[model samples]
Target chain A: MTMATVQTPPKISAQGVNVFYGDTHAVDNVSLDLYQDEVTALIGPSGCGKSTFLRCLNRMNDTIADCRVSGQILLDDEDIYASQIDVVQLRARVGMVFQKPNPFPKSIYDNVAYGPRIHGLADTREDLDEIVAVSLEKAGLWDEVKDRLDHLGTTLSGGQQQRLCIARAIAIDPEVILMDEPCSALDPIATAKVEALIEELKGGYAIILVTHSMQQAARISQKTAFFHLGQLIEFGDTTQIFTSPTSGRTRDYITGRLV
Target chain B: MTSLPNLKKRWGRPQVQRRLRRRYIYERIFRMLGLAAIGVAGLALATLIVSVGKNAFGGFVQTSIDVDIYLNPEDLRPSSARYRHDFAERVESADMRKLLADALERQFPDIDTDSERRRALQLFSLQARRTLRDYITATPEKIGQTVRMRLLASDDVDQVVKGNIDPRVPESDRRVKDKELAWLAALRADGRISRQLSTTFFTGGDSREPEIAGIFGAIIGSVLTLLVTLLTAFPIGTLAAIYLEEFSPQNRLTAFIEVNINNLAAVPSIVFGLLGLSLFLSILELPRSSPLVGGLTLALMTLPTIIIASRASLRAVPQGLRTAAQGLGASPMQVVFHHVVPSAMPGILTGTIIGLSRGLGETAPLLMIGMVAFVVSTPNALTDAATVLPVQIFLWADSPERAFVEKTSAAILVLLGFLLAVNALAVWLRQRFEVHIPD
Candidate 1:
């Protein structure tokens, strides 16, 4: 594994965050930092709470009716849930993608315009068109879907749909983008395309990705966080986390002895 | 690429053909039975159409004679002495039937004092007398002239053309007395007993006398009630469903509401009628036979349907879409109203329409609130006492007169027409809004 040579304040930070649904504690207390212009990955076995903790970063857990979270989650060094903070505005700053592609049942153009339209980001039609174009280009979906902007978003292929969702997320112009197993549902070729797009996206946006693939974390992440049984076992430079994990659980997870 | 990994490749033969086992004869029988079930449904529909068509077609013909409807100035005024406090009060004591009988005796000397004379007057509908009184009260200027009027005959005369009245049977064997038969014979001799198109059947109010019954008022009542029901129920039910499904947190209170909604759906509509009778008619003191009361009852009936359907539509919107909206920084309200609802509209509309159509045909609940009543004039407002289509049919069905059987069938046809029209609209909207999520 290789390592990146850079130093910057994290774009977001979490401190002792734990998530629970009713009586079930899905994510135990965990802390981590996501830096600007760097790709961070969360990886472990199926029940390691990697996805649960990733959701904690952007407050996606708020959508669950029973899911509750305690502990501070900070964006730009400000408490996200402070009385003065607006969740709507906060979400615009931190976007997300999921394992399964779910595009709005509307045209490709409209899907891209949804977030911007809701938040009043684009003032004119031309401005909206520009956002759509740039976001699609960044997602590597523009060339394939350029001619059919009015076509239904759900009509695209599975891989294309995943990229379309990415484009939609980026169209909101967020500072950080989180992907939860974005390539798990795609084939190898699609995964490689998404991997390349992620590498390019780091230049413009901070990224916190959750995946079950160790090789993928090794291939794309600058810093890696390993979770096991609802705990953040270890987090550091991606190479060190893989080669010299400080915790036994982290080492066990890396070597496939525990998850 | 894949140089060392490109291992061995051997051509494999196609797998052996499996044995073809024949299915049991019972399988074929069950399949045929399924088709037969569809046939049974078709047969039921056909039978209903045929029966209603035969009966309703009989109601449009008039069996009455043209008689002189005089505004006998002296008879209409009732001596002018002991009158003039109010025209209605003055006219209330005036009798149109006595005037008609006296005119008949004076006009036709051949008619005797026996059943023969009485049978001759039987052709005139009892309601025709009320019409005469109303006409004079509305227009008092027709005071000395003998205005000609088309009078509706009795139900027995209607039976003659409809095949219920037998000409061969002796007077002693039939309901009509012997002398009345003589009057009918005389009318037949004079060609006064004729069958003409009964346009009044569609204009008059429902009555115990089948010959005078009309469904116009009831049809209008149903339309007005439905307008009120849809306007109120759809918005409230859909909004409640959206809030509960999309915004409300998981809690005991919301769950209690969810359970209550389900239970309310199963509650009898007559119970709703009781509620409306208590709440709107008595408690609120809205007028009886008013569309307002009917509408309130039907709205209660339709609320559960709309809520269930709207929730299903909301649930149909994948969680990923909401996440997508929130991912883009959309507020919870924006996510629901903008994307979730639009996707769910097709289902919501379909469910709403079905609920409305069911409301339209409902009878028991409306009956409980005094919607089934005899009203002669069309109501100008919801507060006016009026009857709906089903209530009109119910009124006519209970009439002992032979013609009411046909009137009931005609009213049924009109109600069915309304249901069909509403159902068609539902189907069209459902198709228009359906968004098939592709695999």
Candidate 2:
């Protein structure tokens, strides 16, 4: 590798994380570093534990009654998996976007304002409206929905709803944002819009994107990691990984020979 | 194989066409059967309403006698010192029966015999004394002017006017004597008797005399009972349902409780009556025949229904909403109160109203608590001895008097009206406030 990398302390770091659902070992020992102000994409096949690991960052797996997680995840050098850590504050700091565009049954203004209002981020109506407007602008949806802020969030188109969810996640000013196949339910045109939004959102917050589209990872992500059969195979710069992957499985997956 | 020729042969087969025709015929038969079942139920309900309505209409117009009551100065201003001290004693001590008898004598001066006086007195209602007392108390100044007032007719006389006595029947078989019938006909001819609207039926209280009995007492009792039941059942049932559906861990104990609640819903309603008799009436020593005890008993009976309905509505809230709220850093309680409960509110209200209707019409539960009493005055408080509509109807239906049959049917109609009103309100609320989420 001829490129000189700028070294910095990781924004979030995982050490020997393992996840189990009842008796099934869904994710075996895996560790990785997510850098600050960079978009890191996790590319993998189905059932490859990419989504599971992404959920671990904010402890989203705790919602599942049967799920169990044992390992250490640290955000800003603070251990997130500690028993004394409040999951509500953890989720507020690290927000998530589901694969499906699941907006709440509320007006667009309220949907975006929900997180901030719940966290007491705004003290007045003007403050809440300003927060909502700014979050929507950041998600690249303000121009389209600004005139009809009172419209129901569910009435929006698929792509707009996905962007609305992104706006909702950033409304609380989360430090890290996790996205799980956000474009899987959208068409190519909408997918292009979200990919562009991700590019624009790159430097403001740490982003961990789990996607099945390799071209998505290559086009928008700066660093990429490949996972297979519950194991992290390779991690490097997106350009280097796409051109000269160090692992044979990553090569096979990139070349479409593994299928 | 000759594939093209074989396909052509199968396409043109007569047996396949015949099978398709038979299948269509069977589908028609099943559709007709389903429609027939629904039509049968609708027809039965229509028949019941029509029959009850026809019988209830007779009770709306009551037979009344416009008697000329002479206010004897001696009767109104009694000569006793106690009468001067207590005005109620003056009205009460006045011999209204003797006054009515004297009025009857003046109306028919030719009837001078002892038997004639007894038969003439029978034309007046058993409640005629109280009616005179009330009039004397209300308008004491008019007593000496000999005012004409409409008093409730006797039950037998009311039955005769309603055409239920069957004048063609033998004299011995009828409760109305020949003499009384002749007096009724003479009164009708003289324009002294008329079919006036039964305003008393709506305003007066329960009575042994069907002519004077009214549904006001029972209606008020039902309102208080349902209010108490709703106050007790709705919050407890809804909270329990939320806990069971949204917060409870799916463990053996929870499963056992769920099964037990379902089983409790199927328990006979009368068993709940017995439980109330023991727990509320006997153990707690609450006032017997009071709306409080009756309401508490019916609340226990209605709890399972409300819980089941509330849980169903809570379950109908999409799981996605819960996730969305949690992803926004809302706590577990917030996830439920902010999203799931709001979405489930309409369903819960509808279910609660339906359950309350069941409690409103319940008679057996109230019966076990001695609510089937002869309440003469309308209950003004929930703790007073009261009878609900269903219990009043039961008491009237058991009476041997022919007029009571009509009163019983009228009470049923009122009860049905109340239930329909409650259900309509529920439907209106559901449509107005229910949140519709896009799929």
Candidate 3:
């Protein structure tokens, strides 16, 4: 980590956040800071609350009937869970890409333009079109899909659909992008392409990713948080965490010994 | 517990082979039972269709005899000197029955006694008098001309022509007398008797006489009733489903409402009719036997079905899609209306159509709403007195007239045709609007 990068204030700060799904404490007390122009990877075993914590950032947990979220999550120092904050507007500034490729059952162009159209970010048809084209390009999919923009989003291959979802998240021009295992459903080649796209997108927005693959966290993220059984075990630079994890559980997880 | 090698060897054993053969035998027997069940069902349906078809064929064709009637101006003129200035009254009081009797006498000169003359006139339908009068009224210049017109045969004569009545039956046992049969034979031999499609059955309204009774009024009534049902039930049911599935919080009250809705779907349709009888007929005092009341009654019956189906389809929409839309900052209403509803529309439409089809065949509820009345005119509006096809079939099926047997069957076929058309439309709409999504 460079001294200059460490000097910048965090773009988003979670202070003592917790999530409960009905009677189950899914995400225990966890505090983390995500800086602009950096990729923060949350790595954990299955059922370790990595995805649950990722959902808390944009208040996606509000959709669950029995899931309750507590503690303050501030985006650029403004409390996101404040009663005055509109969840819809909060989500517009914080977008998400899901674990699986979930493109709307609509045309490819509409899929990419969904967010911008919903938020009224584009003033004209040409502007919306330009936004869709640029988002798709930024997701590394414009060249493959430029000619057939009207095709159904679902008709695309699994990898292309993921890219389309990423483009959808990017279309609204969010300040923070949260990804939950975005490449888990793709092949190795598609994963590489997505990883490359993430590398190019790191400096433009604060990215928080939940991944099961430690190698993926080490390769694509600047900071890494290790979660074990709904609790954050360690948080530090990705290289240091991989080389010398402070917590024994984190070291066990890094060595593929703790399931 | 066997080792792998031992298990592999066991696969080649004779006992294992016998067990495998037994399993195959069981599978074959299950397949045969399934086929037998299907064949039985198919045979039952075929028997129903064939019997109904055989009985209905006679209802579509009518026997008629061409008669040259000498329209005398003196007979048409009113004999009342007190009403000398009324031309319309002159036309209204025309002796049409006498005119038709004279025409039949002219066609058959062998009739001397009043009894024979009466039997001869019985060969023509009672409506033949009205038909002749209407013709003369429509073209008054033909009042003095000998116009040749084909007149409808009575129900007995029609049955005789269709070979439904056996000539060997005694005169005391049959409606048609031997003498009338002989006159009909003569008419047939003279090339005056013709069997043609019964346009009256498709064009005219209900009547006491089977020959002139038609289903047109009933068809219009059914259509109007179903339209009312669709218009009232679809939007209300769909919106209710959206509210329950998307917006309502998960609580005991909503759960109770859901259970009640499901129970409502299972309630007997006749119960809805009784409710309509009290609520719409007795209390509200809407027109009796009107399609408006009947449709409202059916809409009540259809609402629960549509709600259940709509909610089921809405629930079937992938949660991932909802999450995706929400992630893009779409409101709850927007998520449901734009994505969930569109994806579930085909299913909702299919359910609505199925409900409507069920409404089409419903009889008891409509009967309770006074739709069982013998309506004679085609209903022009929702408030007009009307009877639906099933009620028409019911009325015909209960008549003492033998000709009504075929009319009943024919009405059944028309009702079935309507149901088939509705279900086919449902299929077409489902296919046209279904959103294709990979699992």
Candidate 4:
């Protein structure tokens, strides 16, 4: 839309990346650029590795012992898998929200305070309190939950709990937030609320979202990436990816012809 | 109608004749026999309770004589009121019968005037006077009053009043000999030999006479055993479970350890006693019959139960919770301790309580470790030779006297009551500590 927007280096770059679960090559080599300060959506059929590629950005697949990853994943022009980089430290910079909302069995305040406490970002009780308040406010859940700060995080409704989890992740002040289908578990209203929160989140943090709903991807994301058989079939601005695509797979998927 | 039609339409064999019904007569017989066996086992439990109840309830009733023992407060009272506490301690003490004898003689010209009828004093629980004396001594100001205290007579008196004694028995065969019975009748005419319920069963200690020993010492010993068991078992069990379940690598050595744990849980508790005997008693030369050694043996037996329970609790914490913690950049150990561990606490407590209940009635193991029959002035320390409720019951059951039979039954009742109370406490704690864990 503007010359300044076209000038920024990608926040993350994936080139010929492949993911294997033992002998099963679940994700094929694919290349894409995820930019900072934008909602980049990944959508495909089930098992198309859309979520798998999102997981690769933060090295979340390292948890599964049998999962093997290949090719280069770069963050800010350097390979992220360099021997000196610790995954724990990397994860702190890149937070995650899973498909199902999993809130901790702790109070609302503690849930928000957990990330800051773990990362040693806040030293005093007052500092921790301020971080929780700010994080919850960013997630747009503070006003609804401020009165019940002592209530267990798990005791919230599905939508509130998901938002609380997002707030908990963001409290660490991560540079990029990876959300794996964060709204697939919610109703339409809750989904809209999450999309709005993502739009708001994009100003300060780069967001990589995976979703099965094509309309959802088109609605909020600035950039869109379509994956098929673990390959990045297409990547472009959301309007171009939705209305006009360079690849046949992307065209078929957008037209509801390809699974 | 369908079967008949099928038979008529059958091309090869008649359908009704070819069909095989599900039940075989032989199989039916076996099934009936199995069910019958299960029913018999279930009924046997009730039978044991009834039989044990019949024997133990006999101890709560006592034979007593309304002894009019006069007291000399000046003789017992020192310059200060401090010794007055010792007065009750002396009166309701295990040796209260002797103390009452001395006090009566101090004030009366002929206190031994009724030594002949003293044999008839068996109608009262002797523990009652010891209790009264102890109470008055605790509050020494009440020592001079001529209060008509309803002192307990004796266990033999309890049996006769409860109608447990057979009237047809000969004098030579009965502790309540014919001559003693005649003396009891004479006192009864004077309204001096009245039977009353005994609470001394809860306050006194063991002796050769069934009429004297109370469960006070055993209760203290059992409580101390539990305290020791908890102290040793809890942290050790919880740490072991956390290491095995959350941190340790999966390998043959770990698998072997896991197998051993399950096996250890099934090992006869007596083996733990024998191990304790060799290691704690014989080699270490700790005092035999100490609650310390007994507690250690029980602790060893309880550890496996607690570990298994703790592991189960840890496993019950949903994987989602751990993922949530990790996604927030929490360390793996933090994920386990901060999120998972607290949710599992209720289960751990329940398991510990159950382990305690099992340890409470463990007589065979305790006996092997020498907590069965040593006499003590008091439970002065953990290593002192002490008796527990089950051990007391075991000893009472083995005694040659018939009076002890009733004592044995009463001890059984007390042990069961302790179990009930402990279980209730566990349930209360579980409910209070319950996390947001789903059913």
- In model 4, how large is the Cα lDDT of residue B261? 97
lDDT of 4 at B132: 54
The reply for model 4, stretches above 4 Å from the true place, is A1-6, A77-80, B1-58, B68-154, B196-199, B437-439
Q: Give per-residue CA lDDT, model 1, range B1-439, as digits (tens).
A: 6466433332232221121223456678889999999999999999999999898888777687656656676776745556666777667778777667765665567777656456556757787677777877787777688776666677777677467767678767777666556666666687666777887777767666777777788888888999889999999999999999987876899999999999999999999989888888888888898998899889999999999989998898777777877888888788888878988899999889888998988998998898877776777798888888887787778877777888888788878888899988988988888775642
Of the two candidates 3 and 4, the one with more favorable DockQ, higher being better, is: 3
Residue A104 lDDT, candidate 1, scale 0-100: 87
Report the number of the highest-DockQ candidate. Answer: 3
* lDDT of residue A146 for candidate 1: 97
Candidate 2: tens digits of C-alpha lDDT, residues A5-121: 256778899888899989888888888988877889999889989999999999889989999998889999999988799989999999999899989878999999999888999
Go through the candidates in order and give each one's DockQ: 0.56, 0.69, 0.85, 0.47
Give model 2 RMSD, 1 decimal.
2.6
lDDT for model 4: 0.80
TM-score of 1: 0.82
**Candidate 3, pairs of clashing residues:** none
Worst 10 residues of 1 chain B by lDDT: B11-20
For residue B262, give model 3's deviation from the true position in Å. Answer: 1.5
Candidate 2 lDDT over B91-162, as tens digits, reads 777778877887888888878998898888888787777888898888777867787878878888888888
Per-residue C-alpha lDDT of model 4 across residues B4-101, encoded as one tens digit per residue: 56644565655544453334666788999999999999899889789988877667766666555544564454444344344434443334454465
What value does DockQ give for candidate 2?
Answer: 0.69
Could you say which candidate leads in TM-score? Answer: 3
